[model samples]
Target chain A: MSGTPNQGPGLRYPSNKKSIYDRNLNRTKNAELSRAAFAYLFIEMIAYAQRGVSNVGDLEQKLNTQGYPIGLRLLDLLLSRSSNPLASIRPTRILPLLQFIAQTLYRHLFGRPADALEKSSTEPGQYMLFDNEPMVSQYVSLPRELSSLNCAAFVAGVIEGVCDGAGFPTEGVTAHSVGEQEQGKDAKAMWPDKTVFLIKFKPEVLEREEILGRGGG
Target chain B: MVVFALMIISKSGGLIYNREFHTGLSKLTSNDYLILAGSFHGMHAITSQLSPAPRIPYITPQNNMLAPSPFPNRPTGIEVMESSHFRLQCFQTQTGTKFLLVTEPQQPNVDTMMKKVYELYADYVMKNPFYTVEMPIRCEKFDRGLDGFIKVRG
Candidate 1:
């Protein structure tokens, strides 16, 4: 093992110029993606889902699962992309993570923030993440066998993972298809398939959910 | 146009899907639907064989393909049904997979709708790791997509 400067996998960072972290995070924003790139990427994503799913539901879940990593990666990417980016991506509290996911991640993926993040009235450990429509499963269909499965569960898993990774242990996350009404159709009345990603925290997460929920009350 | 319902039948023509959208059309017995699929399958094979021998289209004079021409003037293996309520169009993918769509006959862009349904089938139904081909197709994503597409257009 020659002790050469350019050889071997050692903890060597870039020298000379300012390190990436040394620069103000706000400096890096407004990267552009070509429309065709997004279209092709989305098409390939659909094709990948198509070739892998055993059923419609499984496919959607796969898409959601795919998005989960994006969500996780987005948590940091958005910060790095932020006009006023953070110095070190320190999500000291759960609220910031959810906000980043709902706003930063949502806008990055859907061109807008999620509609809302609400607590389930019945379930104490549960929180609902809302979107008018989920993009990944936008054109998916679930077969009969998967009538009970929720593809959004993948998103839920992602959120849970993020939460857990960030010192917030959580239970399972589930996506419940809640229908949307438009185009002269009462989608909710007939088809309640709008996805509501249920984020159920672990006992620890529940404690935090309570701590967060009891902000005023 | 709104896509009301879609059914995928096996090569044997077994009913693999029986979903409803907006308003499902008249109900047929599950057994009857299976019979219908099988009968339709039998008819499809005959029609495909009966399709005139692949006369090489002037477009492809080279005749590069050794096997029977993929572009035989074969019937698309598509069928349709119409009632005052809705029009049903059957579309077959290149892989001999079938997609039946129920929509309003007067719908301006039914073809696009059918194509989208086919796309959804390929995406959600085909890509699902848990899904097994040549068996029942049960997927939640497919249903959600159908619900959204129909809800928006219908």
Candidate 2:
């Protein structure tokens, strides 16, 4: 896999040191990763993060922190790997940023777009990203003692990291288990792992979004 | 020489996993297997303490980013046990999960196989979010991966 940097004859460059920057992220944009492999690595990451933690809350926090840097790194790689003609332009508005996450980022990570996106009815600077059955939380059955713990907090951290990296500067991002209540009791059996990621942006971010909206950037 | 069986023992001397790959040896009852795992765990602890390696003093330079530890502490225990018919290899991870692979006596490159198994365990078993620690592993993906690796190599 570690071929020559520039696509040419396979010439030996033994003396030169290879750097991460020298690699092309765009080439692997179409490449698919094994779900099992990803799951295993993710599980190990959770286990590793769980070490030296007191409670489930702390464990979730550790997982979130672990995913934060990945989100930051992915932001740059995703932008660069975009096939769109306007790929160079960063997402300036809240809607576009959220769309980028829901459609583009979600597709790259989980091989599908997010289920739904909505704005808060009563609250300003608040957006909701919904997933009927969040991939990360699909198999996780929390014990009664640690019922409040949501593994998707790591995913929320990733979203926060991406937003912050893209200059959104969100106040905080959190994943809440809405479960099957949203679909109502009468509805034919649906996903029990329903989750809504509440994204609350900083006041400054909202102000910037308003400016960007008016300017039509 | 080929691997006949694989077992995983939890830190508390519980038999978390037992799988037979080949029919090279007589099959032990589940109860007997559990007893064997428990006894092995106890013996491993005793052996580590019984034969302690002399400590060597070393200093790590602060500026050396490549050096993780100047004096790396090694896991002390019986690693490989060879018998006339079958050779048993024991690999205890940093977290104290024991992997026991039963192979034919003259199996070559068993150490490499053990290392590969450890890598697979770290990836498929440890990384799985649904798998509870020190519990029986029921991950289908882990089983499939192990099966594929061993089938191709064995």
Candidate 3:
């Protein structure tokens, strides 16, 4: 520190500094990122989370926690990029919010929309977003003992984060690989990385959705 | 392009990484490496400030209204040092972390190789939440990446 001037870190900042908060998210709607870079980063992220964890489930949870904050941050970034950036126009109902995640958010991050969206007939307030081959989990292959592990847990965490940030708290979001089952039944052999993200919203979110619906009447 | 070794010095002059990609160079004690990193960091800081300012006084109070300057960012520090045995190249990132590459003397384009190393460090080490800043980087992924990168270069 002797040769350097005694100035705060702020002085090092560029004079024409631009804040990420001030940037328009929608401007890069067509931008693309290198898949190799993304895959390598995701691989390292998994390896980092795998350290010191006792079981596969703990690894999944760690990945979830890591993805949670990203989800929360992306919630604002994605919503603000919409044609209607106003918070008042944000999706208040479950169906629209699910569509936003499945279509809008998925398209932005993965370059393509999620494969499908379905609601559970037996369980109310439960929705599922399906990805025939979730981009993040494309190269991940679990051993037989850890076959239960799904790398898509990180994506589920992001979804959960987005939901929680948008005033729709959820019971939990989980990822289940349906490749084996779907390959046999649905004959979707190409998508061996098929994953389903089950999002179970809290009871209060449903009640709020109903109340919001009534108020709009 | 006979590269010898790579060393990463933390922002405050600590030795976070020292790896030898090619053999035949004399090795020093770990403590000596630390001292070398500290002194280099100090020298870098001194040299950065000592850079000759351009004669044109394009910067002004109302700089925002002006067109973007064609000049690149300010020179950070001593980029290259030549010796009979080896040539040392330094690349300092905007955040103050420095990467030093030791290659065979007269090796061309060390700058590009150093830039690639910096990219790996940013992705594998800095992005990992487990990596505490200014501490010795023990990330396995970083090591693997650095190894792979050097291998590809050769």
Candidate 4:
């Protein structure tokens, strides 16, 4: 889906340059992957994370760390594909930035917009991202010791990655169960039905959120 | 391939899954469903224990619950649900986690479905950093995949 970059069309740019556009050619339409391979890979990832860590947070941090680089890389890649390309994520305000993250980043990561974007009524600078069924946690059931942690921390890491990759600064992203506490309220969160991604910002983001609030762009 | 029905039972015999992919199987109450899972789990356990071979007396050194599965190579707990029109293939993970796939009696292949379910579990729930093992499954991807997979199979 790569169109010619802003350098304009038809003026032969570096033919051998490693652009995202160049890489899209390799993904054939019928490049179906074997599920077994993915399972083994994921299994190995869990096994590896289990090593050298005594606590669940440490293990999840490891996973989140693993996904961070990919997130950062994807940020630039996704923007490059956009028509205006956001020009380095200048959201200028919290609302714009949050909308961009929930809409753009979610699309980049999950192939669709997030199920919902919300702000905590009681708290400012706290944002929540909702996903009815996070694809990453489909077959998993975690031990109780780490139930408070969200594996989508990896997704949070990715969002963190993208935010950090851009000029915007951020704090850690944590995953939570936003699923209805009662069953049948919405059966989706029954096991891991809903994922509430908590995006805490760095103080700088708050500072910027205010500065931008006063037309200080 | 067509999977006719599927069910999941927790280690404690709680009915965690009850799905009918084919019309052959009869529906029952939630309590009956729990009873069915407990009965099957008991039967499976009994069959394993009462195999013709004598029970090999063995003592463990203790404190090794996570030891490599003793039944790794042996035919572990899994079976087929047979009915007039279809077969329900069952697969249980080594961690006592089980998956049931309902398929047409004459379906050619089911290895892919089982593997795919496990894969989705790993990605959506296990990888979910939020999921805790050995508890109930609540991840949406797993449910969605199960629904989609069975719908097409049916």
The TM-score each candidate achieves on chain A is: 0.61, 0.83, 0.84, 0.73
Q: Name the docking class for model 2.
A: incorrect
* CA error at residue B28 for candidate 2, angstroms: 24
- Looking at model 1, residue B141 earns an lDDT score of 68
A1-217, model 1: which lDDT tens digit per residue?
Answer: 6756774684455666466667665533475566444544655665676685687667666766675665566566556666654534746556676776687666765677887799779977667788666654444454456565554555665665566556666665567777443423575644344677777667776566567678946
* Residues forming the 10-long window of minimal summed lDDT in candidate 2 chain A: A185-194
Q: Report the lDDT of model 3 for residue A211.
A: 94
Q: Could you give candidate 1's fraction of true interface contacts? A: 0.37
Q: lDDT: which candidate is best?
A: 3
lDDT of 3 at B74: 74
lDDT digits (tens) for residues B12-57 of candidate 1: 5677886766554577788877787787677777776776666545
- Fnat per model, in the order given? 0.37, 0.37, 0.00, 0.23
Tell me, by TM-score, which candidate is best: 2
Candidate number with the higher DockQ (1 or 3): 1
* Worst ten in a row by lDDT for model 2 chain B: B62-71
Q: What is the lDDT of residue A145 in candidate 4?
A: 61
lDDT by residue (A110-188, candidate 3, tens digit) is: 8788999999899999998899888776545454567788888999999999899888999889998886654685455
Off by over 4 Å in 3: A1-25, A85-88, A182-188, B1-154
> What CAPRI class is candidate 1?
incorrect
TM-score for all models, in order of appearance: 0.53, 0.56, 0.53, 0.54
Steric clash pairs (candidate 3): none
**What is the lDDT for B64 in model 2?**
54
